[model samples]
Structures are given as structure tokens and as C-alpha cells.
Target: MPNLQDVILYESKHQEKDFVQPHSHQTHQILYVLDGQGRCQLNEHTSPLKPDSMIVIPPHTEHSILAASKMTVLILEFSHLHVDADTREFLIKPVFKETKVWSLNLFVSSEIRQLLRKMLYEQSQESIEYKLGIKLLLSQLLFILMRTNQSMAQLDSNTLRSSWLKEYIDSNFYQITSIEEMAGKMGISSRYMNQMFTEVYDQTPMRYLTEVRLTRVKKMLTETDLDIVTICFEVGFESLSTFYRVFKKQVGVPPNRYRTTYVGMSDE
Candidate 1:
């Protein structure tokens, strides 16, 4: 169960010259743009406002909003301090750490907007249960945000995994030799490996490997006194002729000429 504190709703219209000066609040706020456009400045970061822009401002964080035009915004302010520790931590930390704006248009459903409207309606009521209704709706909204955060965390994990895969490839590129061998070492099919690489890097796995090899080769050619033939085999090219062909094709110069040109530049 969660406890709600200082639960309040505000729907305000701002003219072009009207603005809220930078300030801090004791309770968390969900500021949803209902109409018009503006810019919200939260601490050092600023986000553009439009319809469906929801900004989550953490407790005690300085923020302000200025309208670009006649703008309307709905703000829901509450605290989750009395909630279970995990829920409280989840609600407070990540929302402020990441991008503050959660554009409602990106979600698959419009349930959040509906819930906010329902809460607004409940706030207008004179009945005793209206308070309970507002709390319930607010809780639902927090859970939705939590779920969205979890999904984003999973995406971050996938991105980290992709990064690890690229690093592994970079470290072992000289010995791995082929896409199939690279895939075998990772325990995935080459096709799937290529798919993952392409998704993250926008290039096939083999192309990325080639780029890595080419970069190393370019560095060696520029910095080392090694002969082209030795440099070619050392950088893991099996055929000297194939190396020369690729070097020319990708770099617009053969390896020997590239090395000579680098030396000439260094002498200047």
C-alpha cells in the first residue's frame, strides 16, 4: 500500500508574458500539457512542451515553465514517502535521472490521459469518497510510470549487451577470422549475430570487423616501420593481394603508397 501526501490538482492558462519563476517543491509533480506550447526548465535541463507532454518533477528539484503561446497545463502534486520502500525509490530516482519528459503520444494507449481526466473530475466533486478516488487514480498512474520505466531499463540492458558484443569482437578480431567463427564463439547463428550487429551499428558484423582491421592497419602503416607484407599478415589478412585490393578499395590507396605518404607527411 502507498500513502499519498499533499495531493492537489492545478489547471492553469498562461499568456505569452506569464511564467513561473524557478522554484522547488516538497512533493513530486506530474505536469501534463493539456493544450498550447511552452518550455519547461527543470534544474539545468529544459524540455519543449506540447499537448501530451508529461514532465515528472522530483521533490525539491527547482523548475519553471514559460509559455511560447497561450498555454494550458494540468499539474498533479503528491508524495509517495509512505509507500513501500521499493515503490518509493522507483518513483523518485529514475524519473529525475533520465529524460524528464514522457511524451504520451509514444505510448500504445491513452489510458494515462484518461486517468488524469478522471482524477481531475474527482477533484471537483464535493463527496467524501472523491479524495479516495483521486488517490486510487494517482496510484494507477504511478504504476503505469513504473511499468514504463521497467521497459526502458530492459532496453538499456539490450543496448549494454550489444556494446559488450562489439567490444568482444574488437578484442578478438585478429584471431576470430570469420563471421561464422565469431558467431560460434558467441553461441549464436551468424545470421542472428549479423542482425544484432546491424541493429546497433547499422552495419553487418563482417563489415564492422573489416572496419576494425582497416583502422588498425591504417594506424600501423602510419606509425610503424614494418614492411607492407609483414604488416598485411600481422593485421590478420590471409592474402597479401587481397589486403592490397581491400586497402585500395576502402582507403583509396594501396598499403605501400599509404605508408610512403604517411612517412612523407611526417618528414615535413
Candidate 2:
């Protein structure tokens, strides 16, 4: 089930100067280029786009694209669960620089590329539950992109310590992991990790960790009916106090109240 919102997809040739109309969705939208090029003006930046690119736009921020070539694009619109105040803000916070482009790893193993091809081909076929195929394939596409983006970051880094630290976060992020543990595993001090992470990511290690945890927790809260306390523990917050504090500080509400807001939400 889609926790954040419904899913939609389109692959069509768009004309130059054709606009999608300046609009925002109630859920996040991801645009994956299948062919051609374009310019995406999101927030304030305007950058040239290319084929095999991906852009994730969070909810309710004005954005648009200008076709640079006859464009073939695959678009997915989905909602978030557990999108509590904290997660909500993070989602709304820019995931990427506005008006930037990210190149996909075309060198992804042949099997993975074949899978994507199958999805796209199967999608063009008709089925009573065609959406099922769309969802499954899109999920695969996203997982591959997420993993590739992370690996690229690791490779582009110059330090062995940096690579290890990032790998540890990627591996252990699902549970209640901490920067100190990240530092410990990297055989360095948390302070040292923080300095490097800040230089590399513009955010402290702990801050990035909190952002990841909070994003996952929000998904849980919105998607599952797990009790608040249980959800907190599941997402890796040991103390309800810390959860509540972070929730309020970043998300702008307490947990219980945040959950309640979604309970009656029309879309949820």
C-alpha cells in the first residue's frame, strides 16, 4: 500500500516550451527521464536536464520543467506515511539542490537494467491490475536509484574513513543507530566524523542521522497503525522524551497529535 499518496506514471513526448503548468502535488513526485533532455526549474534553480536522470520533488513546492528535446519521461506520484511534523519538514526540506541534475548509473548490472526494461514494457501492456505492475516496477526503480546515489557519494569521497562512516550509516540506518556508534565503527571520534560530514554534506553526522530516522519514523506513523510508543522504539528512538523533543523541534508537533492529524486526513 502506498503510505504517502497515490501513484501515477506517464511516458510521452513533450514539445519544447510546453509547460506542465506551475503546480504542486499533495504527495511527492519523481521524474525519471527515459529519453531526450529538458530544463527543470524547481524552487529557484534552472539547470539543463538529460536522459536517464531522476528528480524527486517533495509536496507543495512550486516546480516545473521545460522540454529541451522531445522528452520521454516516467513520472511517479506517491504519498508518505508516518509523515509526522519532523518527517513532514524533512520531506518539505529540499532533498536536492533546486534546479540541479543527477545522472543515473547506466552501468548498473545488466540484470537490473533488464528488469527496468521489463517493467516499462509490461506497463505498456494492459492488465486488469496494471497499477500493480507499475507499483512493483517503480519500487524497484527507486531502490536502485537510492542505492546508486549512495554508492556514488561513497566513491566520490576521498577518505577511507569517510567511505566507512557512510557505509555504516547506510547499513545500520533502519534501527536506532547513533553517530557515536558510527564514529566508533569507523575507528574515529564522533567529533572527527562530524567535521568531515559537515564538510562533505553541509550537515553534521548526527543531524543527518536524525533526518534519516525521522523520515523513516514518519513513514511508519503514516503507513502503519502501530501504537505510538511501539512506533517510537521501532524507529530507533530509545526515549519518548527525545522523540517528542525532536518531533516538536523539527516537525512542529508532538507524536500522538501528529498521528491523530493523519487519522482523519482525507487522503490517508
Candidate 3:
């Protein structure tokens, strides 16, 4: 009964059917895995899912889903309705490393999980207080998600060295590159690499890597039809599980559902 409209929730039991193909949407999507394992094949990237993971799929990215097991996913789709710097950057811009798209962590920590649960519980409430309460809670949760992802890059933050590091990440994230190798290649110590991105992008190179990956994965989600596993390797991710974790952390919605929203929105 849940598609990308209003406050929707997906409670499918063993969704083995192929409900759709790769597509894009008018509304942005958010998905949280309540339970079970799954795979998100976004454009050319495929990510394997785990319980408690969350994903954000930017609007207009074509993608599909191939569930690995039974799953309960909480899905939210909202129009291009909010205005803020965060909302603007989130609209598929180069400020990617500057937005939630650069998420480098996915553990929903107890704090965020609890907040999400509370909002979901209040979704159907019609009272003005309940509606405002949900909005405020959602904003807090978004802030937490973005902030946590930003903190994960504190290993070697450097603002002074951003020009060099940003160039490298923008050009070469598709290969098997490590933070150390990238730092060495940049002619600076790894510590400096971390510092530079924080300085330049307000995020570390490692954090930018996740953003780079998601940005490209988003390309695949919008333009291709590859399966989730194939999409994962194409994006230079070795394991499906790791890709899923990182993808969910950044995009905030399952790839398939995100893509489905695109198709659904276009039809409307």
C-alpha cells in the first residue's frame, strides 16, 4: 500500500517479485531497513542491505530492487518542498561532499533510531501539535545523520590542503584507492589529506570518497539497468555488504525504491 506518497511505510513479506525497473522521481526518497537483508541496485551500483541500515536516494536517479530476504522498510517521500542550504546541495549538485550525500557512516546509533521510531509512531496523527512535533523531530534526525557522517571524517582533517585533495578525489575515486595511497599520491602525509578535505570541503577525503561513490552510483541509478551486485563492483566496491552500508548511510533510501519514485512521479 506504500508508494512514494505522504508518510508511507513498506511492510512487504518476502518481496520476491520484480515490481519495476530503473527510474527516477520528483520527490526525494528515504528508506530505513527495519529488518531483513536486501540489495539495492542503483544505476550501475548494487549494495547489499542489513538490518537497521538507512539510505537516501537523490531525486531523478533510475534504479531497481532485488530483495535478498523478507524485509520491512520505512519509506518516506517528500516533494522538492523545503528550502535551506542543506536542501539545495542535496538536490544533486557538486556541493555533494558538502551535503548529506557524502555520508561515511550508517550505524543509525540508538539515538537516531529512537527518534525515527517516535516520528513514525506519530505519522498518522492529525493534531497540529503532532504534525509540528513530527516536523521538528524529523529535522533533528536529519541534522544528526548529517553531523554523524561529518564526524566520521575526523581522522585527518585539513583545510589548508583541500585544493590538491579535492582534485584527486573528483578524478580518481573509481579505482581501488586508499586514504594513505591518495595522500601519498598527493605528495602529502595521510594526516594532511584528512585535514585538507575538512578545510576545503568541510569533510575529510575519506568522507568525500563516500560522497564521490554515491554521486557516481547516482549516475548509474539514473542511466543504467545493471543488477545490484554488478553495479557494486563497477563502482569499485569489493563487497556488496560494504557498498550497501555506505550507500544507505549517504542516500537515505533504498536504490530501487528511489528509482521507483522517479517512475511514479513522472506518471503523475
TM-score per candidate, chains pooled: 0.60, 0.46, 0.48
Per TM-score, the best of the predicted structures is 1
- Residue 22, model 1, lDDT: 94
lDDT of 1 by residue, 181-217 (tens): 8778778798877777777789987887778889989
Provide the RMSD of all predictions against the true structure, rounded to 1 decimal: 7.1, 23.0, 22.0
Off by more than 4 A, model 3: 1-14, 17-20, 83-107, 155-268
Q: Give a tens-digit lDDT track for model 2, residues 1-268.
A: 2445445555657887667767776677677777787888777777677877777777676788888778887666666542345433433333432424566665764434565566667667777676577666655655565566567666576356665666666567666366677777767787877887776777876777778778877777777788878877876788999888998898888877777777546355
Can you list the residue pairs that collide in candidate 1?
none
The local lDDT score (0 to 100) that residue 46 gets in candidate 3 is: 74
Candidate 1, overall lDDT? 0.78
| Minimal lDDT window, size 10, model 2 | 90-99
lDDT of each: 0.78, 0.67, 0.63
Which residue ranges in model 2 land beyond 4 Å of their true spot?
A: 1-5, 81-100, 109-116, 121-129, 159-268
